[model samples]
Target: MGHTLSSLYPVHRRAPVYRPKAFVVDDLATLHADIRSGGLATLVSVTGSGLVATHLPLLLRESDGPFGTLLGHISLANTQWKETDSGIEALAIFTGPETYVTPNWYAAKQETGRVVPTWNYAAIHAWGRPVFFQDADRLRDLVTQLTDKFEAGFPAPWRVADAPENYIESQLKAIVGFEMRITRIEGKRKFNQNRSAEDRQGVIRGLRELGAQGDTRKTEVADLMENIESEPPAGY
Candidate 1:
């Protein structure tokens, strides 16, 4: 089941001048906190046959160890999981809001035509070995935890046990649960960090004009940058 693994694609050359560093989150507690807040992640795997990907709502759990495991369920009918070999490694991509940056947003556009359009986004990639769990109790626990996490804020939070036991049991059988013991984690917050102050301001203004999801995301990026700068130096 072991196969030669290829290195992940490097950050785009045109990306910011910042040196890309991989952040290994050895504390599963911290990792799970992020996963819980993020809600959804994209699962990707490589098989001898080809590549497969799926968007999933993940349930992260921590243990007293270097890395924690991720819990999720996929449709039983999905052949992708079945095709994966025993030792196959997979990647889970967690993405935050993203925005589009127009070329006109760069102040450089006024002096020269050197500027090009780019995207601003935040994401985390988790690489690990996946193990599928087909047990009924395990599946039920996963589902219950997932529901409780999402429904906690609601006045009438829905519970799996609220439904008939037979129905819940039957539904659980229709899907397969999976766990991934993460080995590597890469987090990138690709905002307009590399841009000049004027250029960054222009980009923010442009985003305000667009007023779409991208624009809102750009505003968030601006806020994050401001927060980072405003924070006092360590041990201050």
Candidate 2:
């Protein structure tokens, strides 16, 4: 056996997220909030063939673990569930609003022409070992939970019982449910947090102007940036 530098000084693994000090979100509660607000998640898994990913909405159960449990279902026709390697951890990426930030929005641009365009956004990445199931009863419960969540704002919410029993049971037989046991979680909110107040104000103005012109995406970014002003981030 050969002993190399690794033997003398072991190296720890770096976090999967490319988060800067100013962008990392550390609060568990905040992370959960962001995940729920994001609505849909991109679930990724390492399989024997390679990597596979699926886009779906997941229900976040905070009482499950320190981080939380993610409930979602996939069609049996989709091979991802069968291919997933239990030994490997999975990732659920929840992305919030994102948009381009023109250098014109930076106050420094006018002074030194030193600013360049960039992107501003928020996202949460959760790591966990996914547990897949095919029980019809559990699948029915999962469907009902997801249904009630999305329909809550309506005057009258539709539910699983609204469908015919035979049809509902047949539908359940076509899908498999899964729950992710969250082992580690991370979140990032990058909305001009590293910029100066003047620069940030300029961004807010530009974004709001765009929003007034019918680009609601810009408005979302602007709203988050404005929030930073009201509640200053505890920067690293």
User: Model 1: runs farther than 4 Å from truth?
Assistant: 1-33, 111-113, 212-218, 228-236
Q: Cα RMSD to native, each candidate? A: 5.6, 4.3
Model 1 lDDT tens row, 1-236 = 54353423222211222324321223444446556678678888766567789898997766724566778999999876787654556788887767777888889899787898888766667777688878998999899999998999999999998999999989998999998877766556555666677787787667666656555665676665454345443301
Per-model CA lDDT versus the true structure: 0.71, 0.86
* Candidate maximizing TM-score: 2
Worst 10 residues of 2 by lDDT: 5-14
Give the alpha carbon lDDT tens digit for every residue of 1-236 in model 2: 77533343233332579988888888898888878776878998877567899999999999998888999999999999998877667889999989998999899998998898999988888988789999999999999999999998899999889999999999999999999989999888888778888999999999999999999999988888777678745632
The whole-model C-alpha lDDT of candidate 2 against the native structure comes to 0.86
Steric clashes per prediction: 0, 0
Q: List the residue pairs that clash in candidate 1.
A: none
TM-score of each: 0.77, 0.92
